[model samples]
Target: MKGWKNPILLVLGIGVSNIGNWIYFVAINLLVLKLTGSAAAIAGLFIIRPLAILFTNTWAGSVIDRVNKRRLMVYIDILRGILIAIIPFFNSIVPIYIIMFLTNIAGAFFGPTSETYITKLVPPEKRKRFNSIFSFATSGAMLVGPSVSGVLIMYGSINTSIYINAVTFFFCALAIFFLPDVDEKLSSEKVRERITMKTIAEDWKAVISFGKTATGFMIIFLMFQFITLISFSLDSQEVTFIQQVIGLSEKNYGLLVSLTGAGYVAGSLAVSALANRLSIRMLLGMGSFLSVTGYLMFYLASPQTIPLAVVGFIIIGFFSPFSFTGYATFFQNNVPVDLMGRFSSSFAFFQAMVQILLTLLLGYIAEVVTLQTVTVAFSAIGLLLAAALMSLIFLQSKKALFILEAENNLTEEG
Candidate 1:
């Protein structure tokens, strides 16, 4: 029971976790389209949250390592819920943007802290299983949330959907209360003990001092983020294309997005089962290949063949979290426990930066070109980048082999 309790709590949290978020996503986009009717404004709104995440993540991570992570999550949940609840009450776009920004700020803390907390609770050997379960729960929430919101919107309007989303957040906050206490090492004391500008400088020096592998990993993480942002930023436009060009009904289009969630569930299960037998690097490469292929198909393939598009999107769905899990595992395995929070935060920050750039770039491209062409170009670039990265990783591993052997020899001697 003790072993099961944490996962259950985490899943419950995931259950309602994205409810408000997805609702806001669909509703707000519709709202933006209805209001100003500007494609660029819609794109800006789509990209802004990630941009917000990019700016706050590093500072949030640094703070998380120094504070209680569980508490951070709880507070973040409450704050976000409150902000979401306020959305329906406002008629002006200005307040909506403000709330969105605030929600993104809270999100920066909520996501990384949740990861840090989970890492602390789940043992390394079972990380794959834990991650799988967590993914499933979030996927479930995402699956159900939008469906529920759609029904609510049918009965009432966008405002009613926002209200329902707020209810989901309220429940999420309650679920957070059930999470058990988690112990985390605070880095502040260590910094305080050596409190000096020179000491801070030395610590920064140590971070990059580890040489190219560490630095290179961070860079790869950023690249992967860019690819993901490119994929995600096109989601709204894809739905539009399906409805406008492909002549699909809204119900059918929703099903396509839902398939992506289903793919995520399947992919998470596969990764969890194979984590022991498979090398993380192989999975990482495979997942990247899948994403690049999936997006390329969507961009270039003829929408006249609806079945092909469905299959292509399922592939995208399948690989979505496969690549993310690789990134998560990389960070978990490499980062020291004490610096997990800060490092996770820094990773999130880098991710946010990638998102911002992708959003802006995609936004600009959408102005001149079709969304399909943009997706194809973005995906092709991702695939090419992934291939290059795999080659670099192979070379890095060979070089590091001798150093690893030497270290092993020293340990044996002692």
Candidate 2:
């Protein structure tokens, strides 16, 4: 806590970028909807994103593990700024899709690389608290961004909103420039020893070997990721379910989405303020349990009692901070700095793979079955999965904790 200025400033920078990302997200969806007038185009975004991540993460991890992560972060942000700026100029839908896909490739690398930088910046003991703060910042953006984008599109202009998003990325890059770069938490000699001439395949083999030694931790991590994957299905089908199934108008549905965001913001702030007091286990346990409850609440709601749907979504949003707080702590505390890049990206890659398959499968299911039926059915699956996830986290994690500690000790002593 002695010199917290830099990390706090960095968090502010991240918050700006997070808000901008969400703004662009909403704006682009509206843009596409206007251009093509097709719900399918909006859904195509989910497909385009994970596909980009799948291809990029296959090799991004290996490069991230070897490179200077700070410099990588700088370059990616600058390029992202450029990419967002380019989007406004494209008149054709095809060009927009291509640019969006390229932008995603940059984002895929930026995700784990920034995480690696944070590991080197924040100490292990404070990571849970830090994660809580960071998660709160992002949730706040999720709360604000879409509403702002709507106002901009309605009153101002979509082009103006896109330019604002572009500017935020440039500001983010500028803010990150001030933070001093620490290549690794390890000593210079240790980092030098880690640097190798290995090919991508060999670096991945190293990653595979490390994963084998702590299979239990990896399993826990993947379960958390899988839970997240199932949660995303709601986002993809939300509009259709609300309009077609529940018979809400477009404006009313937007209000419901805003309400969900409000619930999320409140939940995030609650955990952020109490992060110092809550243990990681408590966060994860409560989060996992409530997520299932939220899913079931919405699933079980009668079409006439749609307010219950609001309550359900709010419950899910409120628990967002706690689950992510536990997840970030679990990763930062357990994973060694030397292998953090590959480990995090490998997890991302696996998560992306599941998301791709699930998104496709769930989309197909929604088309065949009624959207409402698919929503509730998937919620049933999420409920069971959440129960299993909670059990794994709470019931049988002693051995996993020991393995993680052993691995951490080895990295530190190396």
Candidate 3:
């Protein structure tokens, strides 16, 4: 526990920020609806986040890799806090959207920067446990944040919730300020290189070169990303599917969401407790396969089998942390820490682009075809991808990748 002080602090900081993010999510939707009285306006808020990611990630990596990540994280959090704090002052929808866009742009940069920082801070042997604890914090926020927002809005106002969220970001910045500067030893020239068009181009080339040279890693990465894309597409339709197809009430849906959060929290705790017991391959392969099966169970369930759907949700939520933590550990151990930011951002850029396209396509298809049919088809696709991912994960030739000590030794030898 003594050895975990800094990592634990890092987790707490992230957890606080996540709670604020969710609170802002609910408040912003209501605020947009109040201002414009249009569902489209609220929907536009959703588009702004991924659009911001697309706009920023192309060059964000160049800056992320060259800067002191800890300082960059502090600045980004403060910037987001300021942007969110002023959101309540905007009576017009356009201005609010503009502010939200800028805030998300800051968020886009922060994601990769934080990932790189985490990789540098947490030792390889401890990442699985660290990530499990991180997952627990995130899942707890998922449960608590919205409920807190509801209370704030009910007792106070939407503005109150927004202001509180802004404060959380500032709190996150403060927490980040206390973190050690892991980049202190990095070469001065590397850190001082001004971000230029040429630097950005070279970073992209380096990412491409890594992808070509490390085909297995890229394949696993993309397959896992595709599975996530499926999950996101399914989530976008979850409300409609539960209400219309499964004949569940809004209250039931809310309860189900709460249950999912509980499941995630429980699963994260289990992973943390059993971190040393479970191998990375088992966590990645079995965890993902079972999660997909849960999705399958839910999708195939009827109104008469609502309990089955409930169980399915629990299963998916519980096992998802296993897959996520496993992948984070795998990624941190495998990717060079120096290139972590660029690799994360570059892949995220493509993932965001595909997510936008896939989400739109799923929405359209659900309208054209039956929602049930579309969801089932996508879930089946997810199952196939998970199976393939598991197969790749357990391959003998790739076994070294999942073993941290062996991989580190191999890297040293190379």
Which is the leading candidate under lDDT? 3
TM-score to true structure, per model: 0.80, 0.90, 0.96
lDDT of 3 at 39: 88
Residue pairs with clashing backbones, model 3: none
Off by over 4 Å in 2: 184-198, 397-414
Compared with the true structure, what per-residue lDDT tens digits does model 1 show for residues 227-320? 6666766654687667765678998987888787888778777776766665556656677778668766765656578877788788987876
What ranking emerges by lDDT with the best candidate at the front? 3, 2, 1
Please write out the lDDT profile of model 2 over residues 1-414, one tens digit for every residue: 676787887899879988888888889988999899998888787678788888888778777776778778888889989988988888778999998899899989988988888988876666767888898899888877877887888898888788889888888888888888877454554445443446567767877897788776777776777778888866677777777777789998878877777877887788878977786777876787786678778766767989888888888888877888877877776677778888777767778887777877888998898777887888888778778877776676544442222122232210
Q: Over 4 Å off in model 1, which ranges?
A: 30-44, 184-213, 233-252, 272-277, 303-306, 363-374, 391-414
Cα-based lDDT for every prediction: 0.67, 0.78, 0.88
Worst 10 residues of 3 by lDDT: 405-414
Error of 1 at 46 (Å): 1.8
| Top of the candidates by TM-score | 3
lDDT of 3 by residue, 1-414 (tens): 867989998998989999998898889989989999998888898899899999999999898988899999999999999999998888999888899899989999999999999988987768888989998999998988999999999999999999989999999999989999999987899877888899999999999998888777788888988998888988898888899989999999999998889999999999999987887778888888888888988988889999989999999999999998888887887788889899888988888989999999999998899988989999999999999999877774445443333232243111
Clash pairs of candidate 2?
none
